[model samples]
Target: MAYESSVPYRAGTEGYTSFRIPAVVRARSGHLLAFAEGRVSSAADSGTIDLVLKRSADAGRTWGPLQVVARNGTGTAGNPAPVVLDSGRVLLLQVRNAADATEDRIRRGHVPPADGRRIWLQHSDDDGASWSPPREITGQAKLPHWRWYATGPGHALQLRHGPYAGRLLVPANHSTPPTDPQDSGAEPRYNGGHALLSDDDGATWRIGYTDSDSDTDTGRSVAPNETTAAELPDGSVYLNARNEAAAAWQRVDAVSTDGGEHLVRPFRPQAGLSGPAVQGSALHLGDRGALLFSGPAHPSARALMTLRTSRDGGLTWRTAHTVGGLPAAYSDLVRLDRDTVGLLYETGDFSAYSTITFRRIPVEEPT
Candidate 1:
């Protein structure tokens, strides 16, 4: 199937040097919201960054002017994880840190508690026009021992079935202090995946299934980072994450039967899916019993943006279509309508950070 693509946030435009970490969600009113991290000076991950967004009224054919959702002055505000509530309210979860505090410093526990990574929540009632002030939720969402924190950087999940219906689940990752006091916490083995659960809309949040176990004796472990979530037909939660440590595959996955409170299936390397160690997105096609995943197809490089379909609840996958063959990085999926799906991803000619583009694809084509 052919895809119709357009660049909504391009590098060296709109007073920003680069844009990365693309996330998208379809508002309750049928508006498509696309978000990205607008880097001020350079394409570096750290430094001054702002969470910006754009709205599309008619699918993704065109986008409105850019809107600054949240800015931290000289600090960094990114990792947008947006979800639309049943009441037509949009809640976004993001992480903030000081401009000078890089991931390395935070992972090594060199940054002070006040300067370390923190989580915040914001809401919008009038679609994507305006947003409320960000409320700090680090105390409730993050553990003190965990460092190097990040939200989904994509669309969050809201359970629509089972006893836990209406519950909000945010896929997150964090690095813990090394078990060996002498060892550095910056090691990839310390990275793990978790979920943030909120029962009452965005009023409160609690930590869910913490997957930080690593066996040093056998050198076998699952260190999941940059995670994504999808709901299966049986009302179970499925999580797919990027493996931070050396593993047989680039992705790891787990399943939760009781909403997002606990994981029934532990984190393990996922087979039949190949990609670079990068953030990916997952979407369940309503009651179709089909799950869709989006990420780069290359195993060693962040290129060849591709989409895969899984019929057996993410147990196996088959390549459905390649969105683009150019340099691509992170991506997110949103159901635009009953027959169409929208994708917001990082792709460009020279580098993946050059532009955050949106593509519209037929939902039936992937099934």
Candidate 2:
């Protein structure tokens, strides 16, 4: 059977010219919330982008209008990482930047601290109805000397097993200088992956131990940026990352047992899973005895929005079905119920930047 998708957001609609970087979460009360960055003018990726959202109460069969959740005026505000707590509260963690600012300048120490891609958070007590003002959490969520950083860009996780039950975990990536400098720009040489947690159900957050190796690996996509995570039945975090872009367009996976505080090993490339240096998503549909991953299954291109399954807790993976054969990139997955999941991803005809889309896939056993 062919997988069907809905174009809830178009490239030029709702006053925004482009929509990108999708993230979705199924709230505790059964409301479905889909999020993306609404680029105001051109799709340059770093200017006048606001975090926007759409709500669906009918399990994605229908959706409401768009609502600007986090807007920093003309500045850039994006990377929607949302997670729903057991008590029905929705916590969103995002990144902020200055208007027209770029990542190169920030990494070279050419940007000011005020708009240097820091962390901010917003929450809603009544499902997706309302959101609080964007509160800066840079001090708590970020560490000293870190330059480029990003959260899940997908649904964060809440531990349901082990001693850290109810712990809210956000899989994230960051970068700093290597042990030795080779450039005059003082550029960041290594990328690191870690998890941020909130013990009080999203009230406050703290950075974890910063993965393995204080001075870890690096790549174009980097070793750990734009990664997704799932909690294994043993209470360990199974992390899947976009390993390297320009060179090896493949994916990597690792495990962390300390409630996402650290990884057991550096993320090693998985042989079967293929990508085009794009972000993907992972959902541990543990009850159904399946581990699901979403991304462009094409070996060297960002087309074919495909979903793969790993029945043996991510030790292996196989393509089950594909969403489409269009230009697709950067996706996030949400668990709708025991037998279904949702995908919010960037896809279009001209390019992947046309608009962020949503797809509903019925959970099935691994092929």
Candidate 3:
């Protein structure tokens, strides 16, 4: 199936040296909002970064001018996790850190609390036209022992069916302190997947389903990072995360039966799903009774953007459609309507960070 694509955010174009971490959502106003990290200096993870966005009023055909949703001056503000509430208000969760505070320093607990990674919340009442000032929610969303933290870097989920319906859930990841005092906490093994929940709309937040086991030697332990989630057909929540373990596959997964409060199944390598160690997105097709995943299909490198489908609630997956064969990285999925889906991703000829494109694909083409 052919796809209609457009470059919403191109590196070096919007006063940003690079644009990374693509996230998109359809607001209650029926407008598509595409977001990314506007890196001011370089494509590196650290430095002055702004949470930027663009809106497409006519599906994914075209995008509006760039808008800075949140900025921290010389500090870093990125990892956008956006969701539209039932009230038509759009809530966005993101993180911030000092300009010089790199992930290594933050993970190793070398930075002070003020300069360390912190979570923040922002809301848009006029769709993508304007946004409220960022309000810190780090204490409620982050654990004291967690050093490195990040929100979805993609679109978050909201429950539609069951008693927990209307609850806002955000898939997230964090790094715990090292078990061994002599060991540095910079190891990816210390990373784990988690979720943040808000019951009273986006007014308050709390941590949920933390997979921070201190023992890395245990075969059951998994280093799940950069997570994405979807609500299954049976009202359960399925989480698919980027596995950081060197010996395991690039993907790990779990399930939460009690809304987003706890995980019934802990993080484990998802068999048959092959890809590089990078972030991916998951979506549940309620009408079709199937689940969809989008990410790179290459086993060793971030390339070949592919879409997979699982009919049995994420137990297994099969290649459904290959979107493109280019250098691809992080991606997010949005349901445009009953027949079409939208994908916001990073892809380029030479590097994935060169452009963040939005692609419209037929829903039936992937199922």
lDDT of 1 by residue, 27-129 (tens): 9888999999999999989899999999999889999999999998898999999999988999999999999999988888888988889999999999989
Ranking by lDDT: 1, 3, 2
**lDDT by residue for model 3 over 248-366, one digit each (tens)?**
57899889998889998788889767989999999987888879999998998999999999988889998878998999999999999998889999999998778999999887743
Candidate 1 — which residues are off by over 4 angstroms? 184-189, 213-219, 365-367
lDDT of each: 0.89, 0.82, 0.89
How large an RMSD does model 1 have?
A: 1.5
Tens-place lDDT digits, model 2, residues 1-367:
6455677688899999889888888888899899988999988779899999999888777789999999888899988889888888899999999996687777676777787888999999988899998888899998878877888788898899999889999988877655565663775546677788989987788997464223334423436667798988888888888764334637778888888777687677787787777789998887777888999988888999999988888898888777889999988888877767888888888798887888788877544
In candidate 1, what residue range of length 10 has the lowest lDDT sum?
212-221
The alpha-carbon deviation from the true structure for residue 5 of candidate 2, after best TM-score superposition, in angstroms, is 3.0
Model 3 segments more than 4 A misplaced: 184-188, 365-367
- How do all models score by TM-score? 0.97, 0.94, 0.97
Deviation in Å, model 2, residue 286 alpha carbon:
1.8
Q: After superposition, how far is residue 344 of candidate 2 from its true place, in Å?
A: 1.5
